[model samples]
Target: MSGTSEGPTPAADLNRAVITHSDLDAPPCAEPLPYRSVFAAAPLAMAVVDPEGLVVSANATFGALLGTPAEKLAGSVAADLMELTSDARSWHSYREVLGGRQARLRCTRRLKHPEGHSVWAQVTVVPLPGEGRGVLLSVSDITTRRELQARLRHLQMHDPVTRLPNRTLFFERLTAALDAESYERGGTGRIGLCYLGLDGFKAVNDTHGHRIGDRLLTAVADRLTRCADEAGYARANTPLVARLGGDEFALLVEHSTGTEQLADLAESVLTALQGPFDLSGRRLSVSASIGVVERHAAGTTPTALMQAADTTLYWAKADGKSRWTLFDPERNAHRITRQALASTLRPAIERDEFTLEYQPLVGMADGTLSGVEALVRWNHPQFGTLTPNRFIGLAEEDGSIVQLGRWVLRTACRQARRWQLDHPDEPPIFVSVNVAVRQVWDSDLVTDVAESLADTGLAPHLLQLELTESAVMGSAGRPLQALQALSDMGVRIAIDDFGTGYSNLAYLSRLPVNVLKLDGSFVRGFQYEERDADRPSPADEVIVEAMIQLAHRLGLTVTAECVETSAQASRLRGIGCDTGQGWLYSRPVPPDRISELLGSPGVRTDVAGTP
Candidate 1:
């Protein structure tokens, strides 16, 4: 055998050796190496089998691979040694290779070893060129390599700490489900997701160490996994539970029945998390808010679905944590609209897309228009003219209210100054601007007001700032001082939407407030047809009367809001309400329309009862 070849011989050489039976069976000699020596000493695990599939001879490497001695491996049935041969297809392949129907066969299979553990190997069988029709079999153990590859893949797909599927795998599975043929065919293939956020999870890391937090997260992952398994057993498809980064987990249901099913899953998750967690000899409790989104799998992208889920999750958090919220398309559309508005706000201010609308505040006693509230409107190209109700709160949330509010103050002051010049003969009508709480605390509101008055040349007395009752009630320290400075500068301060908030009447007398704008709820009570003498006034009449008396006693003028009927006006006047602001005077109109109202002689004559 020439001192044994470096590796296994080629297939052709093996076939030639088998054909020359005399040389293969010859005993080894010192003169030269024999074929049997090379075959026995080959590096690869190899064997020679007869046409009956019996192992006639096997190399030492083959015996080692099978956990048996070389001599004992002979005469054993080769098919019985390999566990994969139990499959019908593998048996057919073995028969075909031996019967010469196939020249060569190669397959990867799990082979049983005498030591009890299974070995993964690549098995190749090639026909020999002998009359007996023998075959050469080769086995290569690939268990270690396969395990390494599997470990790398597992690391790629799962979170290291919790050992759960990560966001990458979750998204991949979600995309596959959405792209399934059943979904394309519009069958009953609906998908659902429960996007959950652990409430107050950051506090755990803050109070305890991060190690404890990590252990708590592992426990959460385990609970979520069990819940997913339980849910899967009850349904046709298995649920995928994944950790979407810190403190967030998601459950993917591929074949969701309906919204009810998703809701039930969310409830189960919440209930599971209700129990306290035990970590490092300490007990900790945490709750979760889940956003459930269920819809037809077709015509939806992963991005859109996740966005909807995120929005719904915020809704769950907002409505109070530890609860589940179902996705609402209409509500989502509204929120998207608001977000679009918020995104456009800063740019709109730069582009001067905002314009002012003024509503007349009529004196109830003389039916004379006393002032106008400077209401802001957005001339949105896509949404048309939008009221402040649509975007003011959004601006406040994003901290852009300060800039937007400043713009409004300057613009309204300039417009009011123009009106003062245009209607010199009319009584000075103050322009009341709505001030957000953020504007008061986060901005130099007094400076902004002073600058607006100086730049627009409008008198400070003619500029009234209206703060919500809640904003005023919560004002203290810097905010209260800001209000006081603005008031001392002769800028009138009015509490808008009165009676709807804390109504801290005890603190009311100390504030620099000059006016109280009664909420619409109190005014809506009297918005009806004139009652007969026998009929009594509505119940709100007493409330409005008492509020008006209280305001007068506090030296604050009373303004009744939402007075849309003649009876409402009459009652407000009877209760000595100083001013009435509502559609009864006029819906908020353009600055030009306010000029028209100021110029019109019938402005006072067209009272609610003038008809």
Candidate 2:
């Protein structure tokens, strides 16, 4: 017998012990019987329902499950289950099972109990073997499990913070879309991915803390999602969105009817992100850089597609950021080569493959030697003698610049010391070395300089560290402090390529710097100066004079760089420029030639091999 209530069984009590089982089991009569028990029992509310959907019997467990006695459950029509608040789907399945169509049926149904609580149960009904007249129904509460499954599904498909599909799910859907495109009515089955990142994401994290950063990321996710939907042009289905990680997000646009579809989609994404995002009460405005890669035109593999997008994204960042770039294989190839080079740089350094040459900084007054700037070169085993331009930027990107910078600093200092030993009587000349931003940030730059000075016995005044204004400004918090400490340690600092960064004057006075090497743009103007040019081309001479005076006022020495003509040199000296460097002095050359030049008296006046 069975019941569908939460009370004990009254039917079994009234029926008393059936003599068939008890007597046959050998309890009261004689020998042990074979047929001990024939019925199955369930630890949940259950009852027997006839083919016409009437309750035939109620067990103790079923009575207890429904909070009613077995007597109350018996002889009730199964349709009366509606009084217990089962949903329509459950009732329909129950009827279907009773009609001889399904052998068993299970469903999650709601129950409104007398205790005023709504409960959920996994209800299973199966045909009883003893004749088709009855059915055994079992119910188990699985409300917790159902909810857990829902939560698990949510997490598996989406990012925890942004609530967007993660990389795994995005790629899965993307692969499916690409496969579908192959069979669909489209041109070359093209799609597009807009890989985007917030421009000032780090600043947001730093200034407002990560708590706010998380909120900002969520806001960005919403903005990107909306943009993706717009780009998708939905038409039932055309686009999917996902947050790859951090400030990075991706949008997959499918069945791109034309190449213009991708371009339009990119524009829409950019437009959407241009607006301000409201995060809590903070109206945060941020711009994103997007890298767009279209399928077929780009590639078919997932890796190739993502890489192309990433390369284009970097191009967006490189071209002043807060913009979009379409992937071009030719441009991406260069980027791939640079990435490969950056990864190989440290090992190359360890292999002792880097070399240095000196470029002269000539004195404008007499066209004589001032000093040489130490420039680095990489004698790559595969690609011969690469100049600083080829690898220094790469080093900076990979944070290998610190190690490379140390090498250049030490080597250049040692060479300066060697020159001093070779020409002891000559005026002590300075050897300017370029300092990478990574070196300033990672290493104890002051300590490196101090130790290098002591190790080489080179004077602190003779070793100048050349920094671009951008490098100084780019160094945040601790790195800025490091620069100050290094300056305080008596090492002369020169602002290389000066007049390039805006707002430089604000930091100029506070910086304990010694020299400003005017950027080549202004210096190159003097290259056209003719021997008989009237009164120094008033504009160039006046501008040069103004710069020199400004440097003098700031107590900073001025060095005119790229001084390639005699007339330019004379004009620079006339304008009170203290030093100059250019092809006019010497192109960067080998160390032995530098040593020989210092030894030859007449050669200094001609200004060849000065650096």
Candidate 3:
């Protein structure tokens, strides 16, 4: 049998030698011109072992391989000389070959030399061709081959830029750390990792080139390695710093004390990388965001750990760069839920799993229904009815807002026209629909509004479009043109969540806006019982009143949002606000419920919950 390692090369003087079992009578030997001469002249490390497991004869090559003289090796135990029985499986196979119960045995073994260093040998044992009693053992030197393989493996497992372990090796170590046996080495039984990414790195690459980018990465790696050394718990417990491709790196700690250790390591990395790097007279400064994850090694897979680290890293970036974020299971759960929501949002639109709930926007003075705001609610099959706050940002990100906004616009218009038809005797109630910035830019807002009004027979004057100040503050070019076209078509425009943005209020007159719906935080201050008329009002009350007067002066109506109590409503009315919408009137309810409340004052709060 041949081993995975290369076999021994034969010399021109190679000859076959056979011997009988030492315990039995000698077998007939033909043309035996002294078998020892043949063994002595062999180039390979050849040894003849008797059935009783003693070295009967060894060639000079075999003696030199084990560092023992051939003359003295005659009576020695061959297995002990080579330490062949160190493991059970190999020992059993050797015994089988010695007993002539097996045809052959081939295996690799590391044999220690008397001279300090070790030699790798491919050892093969076979029964002499025609003889039955003894086995011949051949050991070949494979140290050079093994060294070449080691060099190739080293090149394969490391990053060229950072000269650090690459993704493959990092994951390999992480997986090994979680192995059950790893915890037995007197540890805290927990593993931790700091997954980091450079901030604004692409700008550096695009500005300079990949060569400079690689140098920056290498510099970052050196700092990380130094950090790992300083944070080392012991001589053998230093953290492993690895380059995970591109501008990402990871610092892994095994037997971690706790999250605090991981945090310290992450903070050190951030601080180390903060200093300016002068790359070939080009000064460059950069920051990093790191995600830290530390937990018990048990029951954790490498993939799960990395996923948590990735989520935390994203949070660090989103919360702003140059900071480290620790993994929060609850936050991670919410993130997972959001991911699930985003993946399903587009399909939900096509499935028609959405509905509009109307909240009455009443005349502040008369306490009568003036109009209703259309709020879209997702009737998710898995998560139940979800408010707009839960998924609107996701929709805008994925460009599904165009599809969703169109549906809401058409549905709300059709319902408004139906209400007008149902109550021809009462004054017509307008429907206010919120528009996302994406809808204005990503879709043709003018065409969508025009089509909805034309399709539903709802007058354009009765449909109001509400957007946040940030969405409409700096409107220009296509966005400004779109808003102008909508207003020219007679659609009322209101800025939703007003006063929350930092845009200039002077621009209000320049915009084609028709209304300002005050942010709710300002109105929450009105919760204090309405003070005497002459007394100074709360700061928020003063602010809201000033805003209301400003809007009125600009010829734009004011709608005070989040008027949850009668006191808040009365104060808004006393302040001369044009309209009010909140729980004080009624929570957003189904369209059918709106029909029931039509032609009536804002009275019922019968809905068990608000969307």
Which prediction has the highest TM-score against the true structure? 3
Summarize candidate 3's per-residue lDDT along 441-471 as a digit string, tens digits: 8888899899999999999999999999998
Sorted on TM-score, best first, the list reads 3, 1, 2
Model 1: weakest 10-residue lDDT segment is 1-10
Candidate that scores best on lDDT: 3
Q: What residue runs in model 2 are displaced by over 4 Å at the alpha carbon?
A: 1-169, 177-187, 196-237, 240-251, 255-258, 269-289, 297-299, 310-323, 390-402, 420-430, 435-495, 498-516, 527-539, 547-557, 599-611
What is each predicted model's overall lDDT from 0 to 1? 0.84, 0.74, 0.85
Q: For model 2, what is the alpha-carbon lDDT of residue 232?
A: 51
Of the pair 1 and 2, which is ahead by lDDT?
A: 1
Misplaced by over 4 Å in model 1 are: 1-40, 45-140, 155-163, 166-169, 181-188, 202-223, 273-286, 474-477, 505-508, 527-539, 599-611
Superposed on all Cα atoms, the candidates' RMSDs to the truth, in angstroms, are 7.1, 11.4, 4.0
Error of 1 at 432 (Å): 1.7
**Residue 262 lDDT, candidate 3, scale 0-100:** 89
TM-score of each: 0.75, 0.57, 0.88
Q: Estimate candidate 1's alpha-carbon lDDT, on a 0 to 1 scale.
A: 0.84
Per-residue lDDT, model 3, residue 48, is 76
